[model samples]
Target: MFGVEARALMLEGVNELADAVQVTMGPKGRNVVIELSYGTPKITKDGVTVARSMAFENRVKNVGAALVKQVANATNAVAGDGTTLATVLARSIFAEGTKSVAAGMNAMDLRRGMNMAVDTVVEYLKSKAKTISTPTEYAQVASISANGDAEVGDLVAKALEKVGKEGVITISEGKTLENELEVIDGLKLDRGYLLTNFITNTRTQKCELDDPLILVHEKKISEASKLKPLLQLVVKLQRPLFIVADDVVGEALTALVVNKVRAGLKVCVIKAPGFGSYRIDHLLDFVALTGSKLISESTSLKLEDVTVEMLGNAKKIIVTKDDTIILGAVGDKQVIQERRDEVTSQLKKATAKFDKEKLEQRLSRLSGGVAVIKVGGASDVEISEKKDRVVDALNSARAAAYEGIVPGGGVALLQASRELDKIKTTNFEEKVGVQIIQIAMKIPAYIIAANAGYEASMVVGKLLEKIENDSFGFDAAQGEYVDMFKAGIVDPVKVLRRAIQDAVSVSTLLTTTEAVVYPNYTSNSNSNLHYN
Candidate 1:
C-alpha cells in the first residue's frame, strides 16, 4: 500500500473545507465558521479560510501544501461563494487526470483542460456583473455589504458621487460637510470698543459704510468717517466686503444700523450680536441666529458651520447690525468676487465626473438577474457552520457529478451511486468512478441536515423520498420553498443544476483528458486521505 503523502493530505483537507460551504453560494443557502482561537474567537465560514486552516493542521512535513494553500487562499479571497467552485473544479480535474495518467495520458493535457474550465466559470461571472458607471454605484456596492453605520454609508456614497462628478473631493478639518446643517463662530452685543478691555463709553461703537468694504477689525465711526475720499475710490470696485470687530454696540446704535440685505454683498461678522456682553451663552445663541452656513472650532459648530470652500473665499468682510467694521476688503477682493461665477463653474466641472444619465443607464442594466434571499440570522459562528455543510454538499455534488454539486456527500457519495443504479458502462473502473460519484452527489444534503442537528442518514433518506414523488423543482424555481420534508423535492438534485453548464464542461473535459495533477494549496491538511 502506498503511504499517504503530506501533499495528498493537504489536498484532501482543501477538499473538505471547500466541500463544507459549496452548497450555500446561492440565495437559499447558509454560511459556515470554525473557531480556533479563544476570547471572542474569530470566525468565518469562507471556504478558503477553513481549508487553509485545515491544511496547516494536517500537513506535518509540508510537502508543498503551499499549492493547497494557494488554492484555499484564492478561494477564500473570493469569499465562500466561489471557493467551492474552485475546489470542485480542481478536484474534478484531478480525478479524471489521475485516470489518464494511469493510462499513459499526459497530465499536462488534463491541466490545460482544467484551465479552460476555470476560464469558463469566470466568463459566467463576468457575464452576470453590472457595468459600474458612476461613483454612486461603486459606493452603493461597497456599502451594500458593510457592517458600519448608516452615516458612513452616506459619506461613502456622497464622496463617490462627488468624485464621480468632480476629479477629487477635498476634505477639510474646520468644517466637515455632511447632510446635516451646522454653524460655528459668533459675536455678541451691548459692549464697548475692546471686547476684552473696559468700555463704559457707548458713543464710539458704530461705523458707517459708503464704499461698503467689510472691516475685519473694529473701527470707530470717528476714525472711519475720515475715509470719505477713500470710500468713493473703493466702493465702485465691484468686490465682496468683509467686516471684523473688536467691541459691542450700546443702546443707541440700533437706530444707526446699516448692513442691509439689499447690497448682495457677502459679509463675515466675527464678533457680532453678543460682543462685549457680560453673558457668554448669548454668543452661542448668536451663532444659531445666523441663517448662512458658518463653521468654527472655537465656538458652537452647529451655529458656526463653515465649510472649507467658504473659508477659502472669505476676505476682510465683516458687517454686523452692531456697526464696528462695516466694510473692508482683504487684498484685491474685487478680482475674486467679480469672477466668482467663473471660478465656481470651473470647480463644479472637476468635482463630479459621472453624468446622471450614464448612472441611470448603468442602473437600468443592473436591475435584472438579481436574486436577494434573506438567510437565517444565526450567530456568525452558527451561520458559518451551516454554510460549511451546504458547501460540502455542493462540492461533493461537483466531485460526484464531475462538474456540479450532486445530491450528497460521504454517504454513498453521488456520481458513483447514480451510475451504479442507472447509467451502464462496460469498463469496471469507469463504472466504479461513476458509482461512487453518485453517492457523493447527495453528500451535501446529508451534511446540511446533520449540521442542522438532524441524523444525517435519516435526513438524507427523507430528502430522496421527497425527490422520488413530485415536481418540487419547478416550485423551488418559483420562489416557493419545497420543504423536502413536507414536499417531495427532497433528493437535493435540485441544487445539482445551479452550475450545470459548468458541470458539463468540466466533466467532459476531465473525462476526455483523463490525467490528474497535484493541486496547489497549503491552508490545511486532511486526516482522512482517500485514494483508489
Candidate 2:
C-alpha cells in the first residue's frame, strides 16, 4: 500500500516538474535561473540535468525527485536532445497507471499489455521512411525550418555540399551557433580549384617550410614559387614579402610590413623556415613576436592531427598583409593540385546564395551526395525541442536542425499506462503500449498540424481512417495542418507510433510482479495539482 501510493505520489511530483521543464528543451528553450531558498543556485532547461540537481526531503519521500531525474537522464541519452518530452511522458503514464492500480486492477497484467502496444507503434514508424539521394531537399528543409537569422539560409545549403550530410557538423550551445559561421566570398580561388592535400600520418609534430622555391606536396602561396601562374598576381598587389628560407636576408619581411600596414597590408611571410613544413608552435610564437599575421597549415601527410583537430584539414594557409586565413581541411590534410570534377567549382560558390539548379550542378560535379535538414517552431522552446524530434523522425539521416517539443524517452513507462486503459488482457500490455504511444506521439503530430493551422481532431480522424483501410501513409502532423500535405515527408506522429509499439514489445518485460507493495503509499498525492 505504501509503495503504490508513494509511486503514485512520485508520479504526480514528476508531472509537476515535467510541466515546468518540457517547454524549454531546445535552443529557443526557456531560460530558468532560480535562487533556491536553502540550496545551491541553479539554471538550465535540460530535463535530466535539472531533475538530478533536485533533492529535498519532503513528505513524498523523494519519489517525485527520483522520477524526474530518471526521465531527464533517459531523454538526454536517446536523442542528444528532447528533455521535456521525457518528463511529460513518464509522468503521464505513471499518473494514469496509478489510477487503475488504486482501483485494484492487476499491475503486472496491465504492464504486460501496455508493453505489447508500444511494440506495435515502433514497428509502424520504421515502415514509413525511405532513403534519399541528393542533399538539396535536406538542406532546404533544415534551413527553412531552423529559427533565427534567416540570413544563414544560403550558407547552410552550401556547406552541406562541402561537408556532406554526415560531416556538415555545427558547433552550437543550446541551438545558437557559437562560432558565428559566415561564408567568406572575398578570398575567391576564381581558378575554380584550391589545391587539396591530405595528411594521413603525423600527429602533433611541427611543420617546417624549408625552401623558398622548393615547395612541399601542398599548394599554398607560402610554398608555391613566384614562377607559378597562380601566384603571379601577388606581385601586382605590390605587398612587401618575407619568404622564410634558410634565414631572413635582413629585416625584409618587416620592411614590407612597415610599408604595407599603411596600405592595409600588415605583414606577409611565406614560410619563415622556407616554404615547407613549419611548426604551429613557431607560427604562434612568430605571430606573437612580430605582431604580424601568421598562417598555420600541415604539409605533413598525416590525417590524424589534421582530421582530428577541429581546424586541421586545411589545404590553403594564407598569411597576407592584413588578415591571416586558413582554408580547406586542417589537421586531416589533403592536397590535390589538379582540379577534379567540381571541387574548385563548388568551392567557388560556397559563400553565395544557392540557386537550386546552380547548387545541383555544383554538387553533382562531385561523385558523392550531400544533405541538410532544418526544423521550424513557433517559439524558442518549440523550435529547440522540435529539432530533436525531427532528427529522431529522420533518424540516421545526415546532419539536421529543427525546433519543437521532444517525444518522451522512457517509452516503457507510458506503454504500461496503455495496458491499464485497454479493454483486454491477452496481449493487453502490448495493445495498450501502442495506444499510449499513439497518444503521446500526438504531441508532435497535433502541433505540427496546428502550427500549420490545422484542426487536430479532423486530421487524426483521417489518419485513423487510413489505418483502418490499411493504407500506406499515416495520421501525420502535417496532414492535420493540410497545408504541408503536398510534402512527401512522413509525419513525426507516424514515426513515433512505430517506435512506441516496438519498445513495448521489449519494455513490458521489465515490469515487476508483486503480491502487494503499497502499505506505506500516500493516499493524497493528486488532490489539487494545477495543469497549467
Predicted structure with the largest lDDT when compared to the true one: 2
Per-residue CA lDDT of candidate 1, range 1-532, in tens? 1223332443354355455545433323344445575644435544455555544554432322344345444433223233443445445443444445456544444444443433443343333223334433333222211211233334434443432322222222222222221211112233223331212123543322233333322222233333233233333555433322333245212211232233433223334333243123222222222212233344343212223222222222222233332112222334323333333444345434333322222222111111111113246444444333333322222222222221122221222232235444445444444432443345444544444445657655654554543222222222332532232122222222333233334443334432234344544656544433
Q: How well does candidate 2 match the true structure, expressed as C-alpha RMSD? A: 14.2
Q: Which stretches of candidate 1 lie over 4 Å from their true place?
A: 1-7, 20-33, 41-44, 56-66, 75-81, 120-532
Predicted candidate 2 versus true structure: per-residue lDDT over 1-532, tens digit per residue: 2446555556556556665665443223454555557745555444455566566555463555564555455444433333445455555555555555666666676676555545544443344333334444443333222321233333454555555543323322233432133333112111111101111112522121111111121233322223233123333433222232233223433333433444433222333321233233233323222223332234333212222111112234344222333333222112122222234454456554333333333233222222334444445544554444344333212323221111112222223333334444465444543354446544533333343455746655555444322222222322322222223232233223323332233223222312222224345764554321
Candidate 1 scores a C-alpha RMSD against the true structure in Å of 18.7
Off by over 4 Å in 2: 24-69, 133-136, 139-158, 172-180, 183-315, 318-435, 443-480, 483-532
TM-score of 1: 0.32
lDDT of each: 0.34, 0.37
lDDT of 2 at 275: 27
